[model samples]
Target: MTDQIVPDSEHRGLVARLPQVPRDLAQLARFDRPIGWWLLFWPCAFGLWLAGAGWQIGLLLWLLLGAVAMRGAGCVYNDIVDADLDRQVARTAVRPVASGRISQTLAWAWLGALCAVGLIVLFQLRWQAQVVALASLALVAAYPFMKRITWWPQAWLGLVFSWGAPVGWIALRGDNWEVLAALYAGCVLWVIGYDTIYALQDREDDALVGIRSSALRLGGRVRGGVTVFYLGALALWGLAFWLLRADWVALLALVPAALHLGWQVASLDPADPANPLERFRANRWAGALVAAACYVVGNA
Candidate 1:
């Protein structure tokens, strides 16, 4: 297959992230970018903590590694499917596949390699967790086509990206359906909120390319839509705590995260796409705060 990653030669300020792109295939798997992995891993942490306290640190570490590998694998798979589209997006044009840094065949090989690592991590989980984990493959496989078929591709992303939450509960208790459902719901809404912000950055490109996304769907109502989703996330999280015994302290973390999301919306300049991307990426801190809440509640 032809490579489609467009190369940009403007080397100034933040435009230079590509200059230091890792040469090693391993690093190119993007283990260096912890945010993607952190986003994936957070739901798992919350689930594990909610199931019970004092999780094995080593198990958590392995899950982090799993998150890194699986997220990279997912990105590679997406690049393969959307290489042409990525070539057209300013923020994605320099991606490895779009820039010709990685060929299609090599990308497939790398994808398989990452899956192998993912498989090893899966093996470390309990039988129930393994089963829950395998159930996500279909969601992940269909993710690339979501934007083509639905305005809310980010909703589909929530399902795939947050599958770790279900596995987290299974990894610990194997049952407790209520908590699992609540966790999954919270994660889904969380993804929609942040991913809508992410989609804002590509609204023009997506419109030109005939891709659908929440950013396009919400349009001028992005702040309103994001507020709805963020509130939904908080609600589901509250439900999870209620199902898990409504630990009041766990609800406390929602304050800061809510304030942050509120600030993101209130101060949002949707016309300025960069603001949305910055706000979207800032979810790392939000995830951390929620994870802390779970740890405190679970441990308490």
Candidate 2:
């Protein structure tokens, strides 16, 4: 009944209508906040499109399902690990696990169900892609502890979230390792940038709880930090395009996404509570623009 369940839950009305257990589970998995899955899904699409498999709707659909399930699973795992910490933070205090609305045993069961779906998605991919996807498990497992140990947990997240790039590339063809590296690195910087914006919502709370984040680390200079990361993302993505096609026109495809990132940085207002979340949520569109650019270059 409170926003504490999720700060940016989009389908609150629908979620409110669900049964208590289902609602709690939905809240736990963040189904009401679809942006998490959207963010996860985009890199999968980016790698697929940029690897010349953009037209493989079947594969893309499978990856989307995988993203939804895996992102949910990751959140559940994170909440389980951070329940104590979440209780100390305003934004996450009412989460199912943190607030005791859902027991950890049940939460673990929920996690298993989500991972089951992820497993189904995994079986749909080729062995090389499957291996690439599975390699992320260790990263995922270690991510919840990063904030405790490092100021750059977002960097760890960048690696985990952007694993889809290589998976997509390897799914179609195993060659061209440089292009995949560049694309994956670009996605990593993009994750760091957008996630820094998302972290702004929790900076004050994070600091109080001793949780480190790029938002808290950058303090007043978060906007500038984001600008630098976004610029780096564009540069690396351009490098990926050039490596693949070596055409000036191929680089032009990134212009739309570049302008969009510029707008995000220009309009960013970290002091305003709403601005960071709005800018953060807008990245679904940014991801789409980047994917389109990838398609133009990779499939041209």
Candidate 3:
């Protein structure tokens, strides 16, 4: 109900499932962070709608289900890999695994269960969408390690998170590769932009812990870097719409989301951590606006 981020006091309910559930294991899935699932689900829906798959309500529901299960699964996988690092980060210190609430073995079991649900949803997709969905496994598997290897792991996350756009497009159209690619690329940049903002919250903690992230790498240039990513998102998304519909009005659909991102960049304050997190969370709205634009343009 409240839009607060994952660590909120009320969010404890997410891990409150049972005397049955090991408290540590419950936390590992980040059941408290439903926003993660919502963020993941929306893109898939946007892709389905943009591809004119709105007629298939059943497919949309299944895709939504897939997003929830898979996002949870992804988080589990991520926690398993980052248990030690997460303990080092201020924000992640309370996480089930990092806090010793859950064991690695139990975490793996939870992951398998989440993936089973994901597989059920996967079977509902067309073969192309299924393959597309499955292809992301490697990307997802590798993501937790990316932060260890590169400052730009957010870019990698964008690819993993945005894979839904292409699969959604192909699920209906079988393959509008160019349009899908543009959307996917735009989403990658968008993730980079937003995640950089999120990374700001952990910049000090991350650095102290010996972790690497764009938030630390960008340093004073955080604003400029995010601006580039946001602007690039606008351009690519505009192109995606143009190629799909070839109309000026269709291009106009991106205006609102563009303006939103503009406001975010314009008001950004590098000295203040709150500003970035606010901007990062507001991206849910940005994604919605783009989805609407895509739908109007694609259906027009």
Candidate 4:
């Protein structure tokens, strides 16, 4: 049963210690892979920091909790929806839902619990932010079907995952919709680029299963496609900085993040089985760099 753990689980030891049912539930929510939550949390931080909410540690912590719970809920929902597709993909075939380790009923119950946690976090924000956050539900609900209907599901995911930016911005201040728009747009592109890297791991299986992704659409030009997206993200972020501060010094804040993204693209190896996941996971740091840049530009 321990062997059923997914290959990329970062906390296999912790997950392996759980009882069978609990372990399967944890696997269903992808609790062992913290990357998803981190990715989800960063845009929140980007929005908060860029909105000049200086070190609202308590609010940030609450948002972190929300990120964890909501990311888990999203994964559970995704697994429930994608179980049939998962069964066809080599990497996802052993997933708890697809492998029959967990039932859809149990998964829905778990999703409800996770969303309950998210609901608590939702109350921590202002009413405007609450509405913005609630508005994301429709996007979240639609995401599972994007790959079925379009080649750019990652673009839809970008919309879903980058939503936190607006919520965070609204929570801190109501004005500067232009700044929020630029920041949110950058976050969307960043998600599309990193997720495209992640999708590389499943290209063969996804093609066989008739699933669509930016990775499949780019084909041999995946590196270039990611490069274009990353460059677009940086350009938009730069525009956000200019709109807010109008300083070349403020634009300089983006340098570190730009260099990091450049490294990810320049070093990317799509053909190497291990390489894409490595690069994909590295976006956690990439996101952190951008967050730090946001902090600098917004606070300094």
Best by lDDT: 4
- Model 2 gets an lDDT of 0.92
For model 3, the run of ten residues with the poorest summed lDDT: 1-10
lDDT of each: 0.80, 0.92, 0.80, 0.93
Instruction: Report the candidate with higher lDDT, 1 versus 4.
Output: 4
Residues 24-125, model 2: lDDT tens digits: 999999999989899899988888989885589999999999999999999999999999999998878889999998999999999999999999999999
State which candidate, 2 or 3, has the greater TM-score. Answer: 2
Clashing residue pairs found in predicted model 4 = none
Error of 3 at 120 (Å): 0.4
Tens-digit lDDT track of model 1 for 187-281: 99999999898788788888997999998988889899999999999889888877777567667856877887788778778887468767876
Candidate 3 Cα misplacement greater than 4 A, ranges: 1-26
Q: Order of candidates by TM-score, top first?
A: 4, 2, 3, 1
Q: Could you tell me the lDDT of residue 34 within candidate 3?
A: 58
Encode model 3's per-residue lDDT on 33-148: one tens digit a residue.
55667678667766777886454678878987888888889988988889889877777877777766677888889999999999999888779889988999999999999988
2 against 4, candidate with superior TM-score: 4
lDDT of 4 at 265: 99
Q: Regarding TM-score, does 3 or 4 come out ahead?
A: 4
lDDT of 2 at 209: 84
For candidate 1, give the lDDT: 0.80
